[model samples]
Target: MTKPIKILSFNIQSGMGMDNRRSLSRIAWVIKCSGADLVGLQETDKYMKRSCFSSQARKLARLLGMHYVFGGACKPAFFSRFGNTILSKYPIKGHKNTLLPGTGEQRALLDVLININNKKIRFCNTHLGLSTSSRQKQVNKIIELLGEIQLPTILTGDFNTTPNDPVIEQLRACLERKSVSTESKNNDLKTYPSDRPSEKLDYIFLSAHWKEICQTTLPGQASDHLPLLAAARFIS
Candidate 1:
């Protein structure tokens, strides 16, 4: 029997905390405390000035001793290369980044393949658009990309919308029938505006090929959005 996969999804906001202090160490500590097997991160910097022109993904991966892949969505005014990141305990066999359709900021989806206990697993990470209409179109594009999944897959990231939003419904229509729960002890479970969260933005999704063990949104702190932790077992 294969062990369950421990997963975490966080939008680190380029490693800035609620106090306006930038510390990758703090971000790494949050992830380490989770004991996660795989992590999907958003708003990461690739040699950006704000982050001291350092590779934030590489730094965090090194801190956790995990393999990482940084997908650059776009460069803002030639100041930084920003996008999504995936950190995993297992070696990445292959990966790709798909640019989503949007009128606002350029967005991207990162899909990576890895083998765990002889099981092929696909980890899909993304940060969707901000506006409702843009998010709707981005969700449609993501659905098409997820269609190629031939193995057990976990889709996660900061989706920038409440669970009941129509965009989520559209995504549900494409995902395999499975219960994707986001229950936390804290009843509200909001994730934006770190100081006092007021929105359910981050998420973790599992395919029917997997069974959910548990899921929850961690308290906001290191970023504008709180981190979401989820665990599941792959079904043969």
Candidate 2:
């Protein structure tokens, strides 16, 4: 059997409605269409009590028919009203939320270890701070966390920076491969400002252990940014 893994990464924008519109259903459908084996989401929110709080990672996971891990990067719960989430078809063996310290706002790095056909892989998902300075700190924490894992790595989420930026450079410095475009029509799918996307804020990166066969950006949206998906194989 082929040991190929399909992964998707998205920034959902928390399904917020400035026009008083909620579109979680729409977001879910777009994700389903991607046919990804695993998904990394940003800006997922949920309401705990009276206060509108939560990053709806669990709900989205259920909708996708997958298991999930929510990483609390900023606060104990809902500091930024959002956090990172990972939905996977493989069984999760381990997970941790790595916190990034900075003055602007709290950020998160979610790490999950999963077993697929007995092959263990480590998946990292996160949404970085907007400011360049904040991202440097977050990225450093990720590099540190990655050093502890022996499984193949797959990192995904809204970087809030472009491929040419310094932060992305740092990410590429460690990761073996990065997805720029896709054949699944998900390539160059700019996701920011639902009205019109100009910035490429999402990604799915791979380690040297994985061989990428195809990549694409899906068309359509339930959030401000579109999703990125990639098809990869374990290098023989």
Candidate 3:
């Protein structure tokens, strides 16, 4: 029997919680408690003064004892960069970062290949733009990239849009929404504005080769957005 893989997606808002506190340790603690074998993070800062110039991705990986790769969507300053990151308990074999089409703040898709249980699997992490037009274009680009990968893939991120949005609808046509559950009660799928989550912005999509076991949002004030966690086993 194959072990179920635990996956998590979170938009940490540079480690700022709803209470306006910035603590990477808190974020790490939430992830650690989740016991996620794979984690995709958005809005991470690298050498940014606002977050005390800490390398958020590296620090979290170190704290959790995992391998990680960061993709900078934009460099607001010469020494500071912000973007998405992926952490895995397994070894990362390769990675690529591509900037998406957007008129507002730059966004990126981080594609990574990792060896999990001696099997290669592709993991893609991204953060979409706020505008509908930009999100449409970004979604198109993501779909295009997804077509090029042959391995069983898992895509996770903070899409900045609700589940009913057309962008999400388009993605559903190509991949399975692994984080959504029919049995969820009391709006458990909502992941934004952690204090009072009223929107479903974060998501995890998996290829047909995986079967979802369970999914839920982790409770924590580590960031403005709550973490989405899911477990699945490879069908093959």
Candidate 4:
């Protein structure tokens, strides 16, 4: 029997009016068309330039009929900026959203618990810093934050660092410490440079506690970056 779990991670580029100034609809379309069970969104900016309207997070959730979560870019979120957001079709048990310890355009890690057929799956999503050095620090902070989570986990997001980078190497080591079989042959799909992709800054890594059945990148253009999706069967 085959149980397919559709997971997707996208850095929507803050919807900075690039899609004919139709950010909300674009996001909704992506959510609807992609048909993801769980989605991790980076650069999921939740506010208008003037902060007059509802958050983009709430708007997108309402549109997709999914539970929503957001991690503010600041530790205390002094400026009330959006960092990362997660949308889940399944009922959420709980979540932890917080900013990474760094001084940049504001970044955060969102830890959410999702109930899948009476089983809980933990998702850790985040968008890392832009610079290499900043990304290193951000990756370290993410690792630190992840240590607190006690559940079957799937780390998905636009980490902003390629697999070759030292930061990414360290992150890979610290996370997914348990070795799982990788049956995916689509690891070569690049996700950045939206127009014509190159390099993989996004990923969906399984925890030792779960057995990944399949993984691949969704094909289509819904945003600046392509989405990375994976399906895993929990080991009982």
Candidate 5:
């Protein structure tokens, strides 16, 4: 029997906490404490001035002793870039970044294939556009990509929308929402504005090959958005 894999998704806002302090170590601590086997992060900086030129993905990977891959959403500028990342305790076999169609702040979908306990799984991480139309287009692209892969997949990110939105409904049609546990009584899964969350912008979706064991939101001020942790096992 395979043990359940713990997955986490977080928008670290470049490691800037609600208290206005940028600390990659602090962000790493939150992820470490979650005991996540796979992690997807958004708004990570790489050699960017604002975040003190730190490669947030590399820093966190080193801090947690995990393998990582970063996909730059923004155009390169003097060796600096910003985008999404995937960190895995398992070996990452291959990875790529696909640019999503959007007007402002170029978004990207980071796709990676990981070998977990001899079973291969596709892990995708993304941060969608703020506009509804843009999100719709991005979602379509994501769906198209999912159709091309036959392996079990897990998608995670800050969707920038609530559960009631039509986009969420569209995604739920193809992938199962595994972040919300039926056994848990907590109805509110809001993750934005870490200080006082009112919106549920973060999410985790899985393919039919997996079964959800449990899920929960972690309490922390390491980033503006709270982290979501979910545990799931392969159905086979």
Candidate 6:
């Protein structure tokens, strides 16, 4: 029998905590405390000045003792790769980084294939653009990509929009997936502006094929956005 999988989605803001201090160790500690098997991280840095020129993803993965892959969206000086990442306890069977359609800045979707109890599952990590129009196109592209994959998938990230946004509606129309937390609950439990969160910018959307066992947001000042933890089982 396959065991339930614990997942975490966090926008580490380049490892900058609420105190405006950068610490990858603190970010790793938050993720570790969540007890997640697969973690999707956004706003990660690679040799960037913000995080002391360290590869935030690699360092966090090493700290947590997990395999990791990073997707670069923007290179400030064409030297550092900054974007999203996926850290997994299971070996990554395969992976891909896709650039999303947008004009504000280059955004990407990082997909990793991992096996759980011999069953293949796809974990997608991404951080969408902040504009309304760009986000609309980006969401369309994401849905289009999901349509091509047959494996069970878990899409997690900071969408920068509320749960009622039309973008969310479009994604639901295509993937038929549901956010781990209910819309009302998400509104009540804002995740942004860690000091006084009042926005629902983060999410973990699971395909209809997966069964959600539990979902909750973790309290923290490690980053501006609080991390979300969820437990689920594949419905195979």
Off by over 4 Å in 3: 177-188
Candidate 1: tens digits of C-alpha lDDT, residues 86-138: 99999889999999998889999999998786678899999998899899889
What is the C-alpha local distance difference test score of each model? Answer: 0.84, 0.74, 0.89, 0.74, 0.88, 0.85
Report the alpha-carbon TM-score of model 6 versus the true structure: 0.94
Clashes of 5: 0
Off by more than 4 A, model 2:
1-3, 17-20, 48-55, 75-81, 177-189
Q: In candidate 4, how many Å is residue 83 off?
A: 1.4
User: Across residues 1-236, which tens digit of lDDT does each residue of candidate 2 receive?
Assistant: 28668898888766653354566667778878888888998777645331245447767777777888887654434444457788998889999887776557678888889998888888999888888878888888888878843567899988888766777766766776443333224435566655577877787778777778887667654666767778898775
What TM-score do all the candidates reach, one by one?
A: 0.93, 0.85, 0.94, 0.86, 0.94, 0.94
Better of 5 and 6 by TM-score: 5
Per-prediction CA RMSD (Å): 2.2, 3.5, 2.4, 2.9, 2.3, 2.0
Give lDDT for model 1: 0.84
How well is each residue in 1-236 modelled by candidate 5, as lDDT tens digits? 46889999999999889999889989998999999999999999999989788888998999999999999999558999999999999999999899999788899999999998788999999999999999999999999888844688899999999887888777766775443333223337889888899888998887777777877899989998999988888877
Query: In terms of lDDT, which candidate is stronger, 2 or 6?
Result: 6
Clashing pairs in 6: none
Instruction: Point out where model 4 deviates above 4 Å.
Output: 16-20, 50-52, 74-80, 148-150, 181-187
Supply the global lDDT for candidate 5: 0.88
Between candidates 3 and 4, which one is better according to lDDT? 3
Q: Which model is ahead, 1 or 6, in terms of TM-score?
A: 6
On TM-score, who's better, 1 or 5? 5
TM-score of decoy 4: 0.86
lDDT of 6 by residue, 119-173 (tens): 8889998899989999988998898888764677889998989878999767655
Clashing pairs in 5: none
Model 3, residue 111: what's the lDDT? 96
Model 2 superposed RMSD (Cα): 3.5
lDDT of 3 by residue, 100-168 (tens): 998899999999999987899999999999899999999999999888546779999999998778888
